[model samples]
Target: MTSPHSKLHISRSLNRFQTQITIFLPRVAVSKMTVVHIVLIKFRPGVAQEHKDTVIQELNKMKEMDCVKHHRLVVGTSITVPVERSKGFEIALVSFHENAIELDKYRNSEEHLRITTTHIYPHQEESIRFDFEVAPEEEHLWTFLPIPAEN
Candidate 1:
C-alpha cells in the first residue's frame, strides 16, 4: 500500500498534467477555417470575345498553384430558372483556399497581379468581389423524411 504522502504526490502530479492538457486543447480544437473568394467580372462594352476567353484561361492557371485548394471559372449564362437578379456580369470566379494565410499569399502572388492588370483589368469595366470563411461541414446525424411524389 502506498503511503499517504506518496498518494498526495501522485494526485498533485496528475492534476498538473490535466491542467497542462486543458491549456493546450484550444490550439488543437480551433483549427484553421477555410477561405473562399468569389469574383464577378463584366468586360467593357465592345471587348472582344477572344480577350474574355484569355482572361478566363489566365484565371484557370491559378488553380494549378499550391495555395489554391480549388478553383472554378465560369461564364454567366441565361437564367433558366426564373430568378430576378441583376444581369450583365459575364464571368464568375470561385476559388477556395486552405486557410486565410494561403489566400493572402495567392492574392499577392506575381502571376495573379500580372494577369489581373495586363489581361483582365484593362478589359473589364465592372467587378464584384466577396470573400468569406466557409463554415465547417457538419455530420448528418438527423434522419430525413421521405418526400411525397408530385401528382
Candidate 2:
C-alpha cells in the first residue's frame, strides 16, 4: 500500500484470491522506485486516424531513449468501461522509467521536446498526465509465481 513496503494486500476478486506481505528494509535496500508515467489524450475534432497514428508512432520511439526503464512503454486506445468516464479522451500512453531522476531526464530531454513540439502539442485539444512510482519487489509480489517475461 506504500513505497518501500509499509503494508499491502494483493488480490484478485475474480478468483477470490488474496495475499498480504509487508516488510521494511534497511536503508541500503530501498534502491529507488520504478517510475510510471501515464497520459490520456483528447484530440481536436476531425483529426484523421493517420495523423493520430503518426503521433503515436513518434511517442513509441521514446521508449528507445536511454533513460527509459527496460524500454517499457504502452500506447493504446481508451477502453474504459462506461465510456462516459473517459471524459472524451480517446487515447492513453504509459511509460516506465528507472527512477524519478530518469523520469525527469526523459521529461526534459531534447528528444522529448522535439517529439512533443513537432508532433503532439499542435494537434491536441487537451491532454492529461499522471505519474506514480512502484517498488520493484512489491510489483513482483503481484504474481504468486514467477512468470516468464519476454523483455
RMSD of each: 16.7, 15.2
Estimate TM-scores for all models.
Answer: 0.62, 0.69
Task: Provide the overall lDDT of each model, using Cα atoms, as 2-decimal numbers.
Answer: 0.66, 0.77
CA shift at 117, candidate 1, in angstroms? 0.5
Which portions of model 2 show Cα errors greater than 4 Å? 1-31, 141-151
Q: Model 2: how far is 128 from its true place, Å?
A: 0.9
Candidate 2 lowest-lDDT run of ten: 6-15
Model 2 clash count equals 0
Measured by TM-score, how close is model 1 to the native structure? 0.62
Model 2, 1-151: lDDT tens digits are 4454344223222224444434453334434878789999998898899988988888898889889877778788878989999998988888888787688678876677677777778888999999988887776642344458988
